[model samples]
Target: MTDRTATAPDIVTGAGTDDACCLFQRALGERFKDLPRSVRDLHTVKGESGWQGRARVTRGKSRIGALICRLVGFPEEAEDIPVSVTIERRGDMELWRRDFGGKMFASVLCLRNGEERGHITERFGAMAFDIDLQLADDRLQFPVARGRILGVSLPRALLPVSEAGEFEMDGRFHFDVQVSLPGIGMLVRYQGHLNPVRSDD
Candidate 1:
């Protein structure tokens, strides 16, 4: 069989008014923006097995906390993984709100050529947490829940890249991530894509 995997290109650079609405909608989808209830959808990889399931969100109700997202996928590799994400909105400040949280789940959906790999899920919190950014001498700095931090540095040529394309928007948003699990030791050098959903419906 021929390998049909699509390779992403290096980040591109450009200048365009960074629109929050565009970014949010691109990350979480328009359906999630207006709904205050549970939501679900299918997730697929370009040349790999796809996942189909639903996500339930209990808004500020129940003992779980404020916001909770529960998603279930398919295939033996991802069948047992249930991503549990919690979202909390900070103060009612003007524009940006402080957001921070962790993801607790597991799956082999990120595998490349049968090797189990760590993949970033679309429902991950960091994917949709928006904030105001500043360009320093040559670096980009943004604030998180803990404090001001250094944001991902993309080449000047890859600024306008969206989640739709293979290079810019793949299964995983950040290619460089350091995750340390109890028994799993550490997961490094991870990357993948969350293929774009067709249609606005």
Candidate 2:
């Protein structure tokens, strides 16, 4: 597997202003001081501490939604899954990485006007797919993106409905996300709170 992040130098460049870059880096620095050492030491997500939480995944209600989830290798049902996530600076772009159980996932996020756009790559068994994603405020919005399976583009109609968001509550981060399809509501949804952890813990 290739590290797409390492190959894209231009992807991290082109911030609109030095002020924005400074603010982003400063924010990450404060955030990094709050993470577990193991996660903070990763090459891409380095120098930052983040949150740990538990999330639940509910099965979709509609048959189409269930089918889409299965096609993408999501579990039929899951709950209280432990999660650890971090966001750090890699060159000029932000590197966000999440560890769900032992599965590793990552995205390279570009921030503009308090919003973000990025490429997400997820691995399911032996298959890995690239997804386009955007985030504004606390809401994750997808504007007609495609998934690749075995180097082939999957059908748009079958794409799981994607909904996600994150925010702070009680000084901790919280997030909720759902994937569904037309007529088949909520293939999977996960939500939980994230608390800061120390490197020694």
Q: Please provide, for model 1 over 1-201, each residue's C-alpha lDDT reduced to its tens digit, 9 standing for 90 to 100.
A: 001111122112223413332222233343323322111222211121222222221121222221122221111112122222212111111111111112333211111111212211121212222222222332222322111113444342322211111122223321112222223332221222232233352
Name the best candidate (by lDDT).
2
- lDDT by residue (tens digit), candidate 2, 1-201: 123422344244544534333323333444433433332233224346576788776876777666655554454355678877776654445555666665555555443323332443443333434445444553334433555556576777765456765555555566677766665666777677677766777
Best by TM-score: 2
C-alpha RMSD of each candidate structure in angstroms: 18.9, 7.9
* Worst ten in a row by lDDT for model 2: 35-44
lDDT of 2 at 13: 50
Could you tell me the C-alpha RMSD of candidate 1 in Å?
18.9
Alpha-carbon TM-score of each model against the true structure: 0.20, 0.53
